[model samples]
Target: MAAAIAARLFPGRIYVASAGVRRGSADPFAVAVMEEKGLDIRAHRPHTFEDLEDMNFDLVITLAPEAHHRALELTRYYAVDVEYWPTADPSATAGSREQILASYRNVRDGLEKRIKERLGWTPPVSA
Candidate 1:
């Protein structure tokens, strides 16, 4: 979701990639929440840090404690900047359908907000 939001917000200005500590499948709730914001993550496949094709990145923003630690380890081999955002994994949230979606949406919105703030992104003016 962070990659999707950052890509949409910055487009050609910067490159964005997202990965976790381990490979996993996409979350249906995540796709739904992203769709709510007009961002499609239905095809987004969760990958691990090892799956990255290129390691030449300027910055890597990790959303989980494990991922943050894994990313810190990467600094030993790659010259990259790592920032931890301490995001909660909404997949672990237990509730009804709407409640589950709400959890995912919270994560989506929070990630988008942090990305915009960290990257200095502002919506364009309507003329």
Candidate 2:
């Protein structure tokens, strides 16, 4: 969700890679929420930190403690910045269909805001 938002908000401005300590398929709820934002993340594959060793990253914003720790470990060998945003794991939220989707939507919206603010991006005026 964060990666997709950042990419859309700041296309050529920076290179963005999304990696975790563990790899898993993109969350369906996350994909659905992003689609509501007009961004298709169905093809976004989850990757681990090791999966991107050959790639260089300027900054890594981790939403979970485990990721932050792993990214800090990455800093031991690579010159990169990591920031922890302490985001809520929407998947952990328990509720009905609409209520559950609300959780995903909240995460999606929060990530969009943070990505815009942290990366200093403002949408171009639509003419």
Candidate 3:
């Protein structure tokens, strides 16, 4: 979701990728929430950090503690900035479908806000 939001917000200005410590398919709820904001994440395939072909990122943002630890270990030899952004795992929420979706939406919205703020991005004026 972060990568999708960053890609939409910055377009070709930056390269953004999302990887996890554990590999799994993109959650349907996550895809739906992103699509609500006009971002398509339906094609996103979850990959582990080991699957990254390039480790040349200028900045690595970790949304979870395990990822932060992995990022630190992986980037120790390189001069990359690693930031840990603690986020709630909406999948842990227990509720009805709509209520559960609300949790995912919260995560999506928080990520969007943080991405824009941290990247110093303002939405381009739509003409």
Candidate 4:
């Protein structure tokens, strides 16, 4: 959802990417929930921090607390802004499919709202 909002708000102005502390496949439940907001996650495959070492970014935002620790540890060697966003772990929620999907939607909506509140605005014109 963050990626989707960033994609919409910034378009070609910013490069937005997401990776996990550990490598894994993209969660289907996540894809479903994101689709509710018209964001497609079908092609988004999960990656590890190691896959992200070559590039530089202005800010590194971590959604999960565990990811916050890992990002801080990583950025200590480099210089970048690390912002921790405490978000719920939808995967940890227990219930039926609809219940689980509701959890995902809540997380997705929260992320979308936060992203908009944080960065949704007109970009400054470049000289």
Candidate 5:
């Protein structure tokens, strides 16, 4: 979701990739919520940090503690800025479809806000 949001908001400004310590399929709820904001992440494939061929990122933002630890360990040999952004795991929420969707939406919105704020970006003007 962060990657999708960053791509949407920033366009060609930066290279953004989202990976984790573990690999899994992209969550359906995540795709749905992001689609609500006009970002299609339905085709996104979750990748592990090892899948990344480029370890020369100027900044690495980890949304979870385990990821932060993994990123630190992986980037220890290189000079890269690692930031831990403790984001909630919306998948942990168990409830009805609407309730679950709400949780995903919350995460999606929060990520969008954080990406913009952290990157010091303003929405592109639509003409």
Candidate 6:
């Protein structure tokens, strides 16, 4: 969702990608939720943070608390700004299909809001 919003709002200004601490397939619920807002996450694949080592970024935004700590530790080897976003883990939510999907949607919405505000970009509307 962050990547999609960034792509839509900032175009080429920032390069956005997402990775998990451990590699896992993209969550179906995540795809459904983002689709609700017209963001297609269907092609996203989970990546390891190590895969990002070769890339250069001006900023690293960690949406999960654990990732924040790890990103901080990783940043020592490179010079870049890292910010913790403290977003909830939608996968941890337990409920029926509808409820679980709602959680994911909330996460997508939260990320979109945070990214727009932090990056000084305009909010994205459903497309």
For each candidate in the order shown, give its overall lDDT on alpha carbons: 0.87, 0.87, 0.91, 0.81, 0.89, 0.80
Which of candidates 2 and 6 is the stronger one according to lDDT?
2
Q: Which stretches of candidate 3 lie over 4 Å from their true place?
A: none
Best by TM-score: 3
* Candidate 2 runs further than 4 Å off: 53-55
Candidate 5 lDDT score relative to the true structure: 0.89
Give per-residue CA lDDT, model 1, range 1-127, as digits (tens): 8899899999899977888887777888888888888988887888988988878898999888888898898776877888989898898999899998999889988998898899999888899
* Residue-pair clashes per candidate: 0, 0, 0, 0, 0, 0
Give a tens-digit lDDT track for model 4, residues 13-74.
Answer: 78888866888887999999887778788888778777875647778888988888887877
By TM-score: ranked, best first? 3, 5, 1, 2, 6, 4
Pairs of residues at least 3 apart in sequence or in different chains that clash in candidate 6: none
Q: Per-residue lDDT tens digits of candidate 2, residues 1-127?
A: 8988888888888888888888889888988888998999999889898998564777889999999998898776878777999999999989797888999999889988888888888769998
Most lDDT-accurate candidate:
3
Superposition error at 82 for model 4 (Å): 0.6
Q: For each candidate, what TM-score against the reference?
A: 0.93, 0.93, 0.95, 0.86, 0.94, 0.87
lDDT of 5 at 23: 77
RMSD for all candidates, in order, please.
1.2, 1.3, 1.1, 3.7, 1.2, 3.0
Rate residue 92 of model 6 by lDDT.
Answer: 94
Candidate 5: the clashing residue pairs are none
Worst 10 residues of 1 by lDDT: 73-82
Q: Output candidate 2 Cα RMSD.
A: 1.3
Measured with C-alpha atoms, the lDDT of residue 36 in candidate 6 is 77
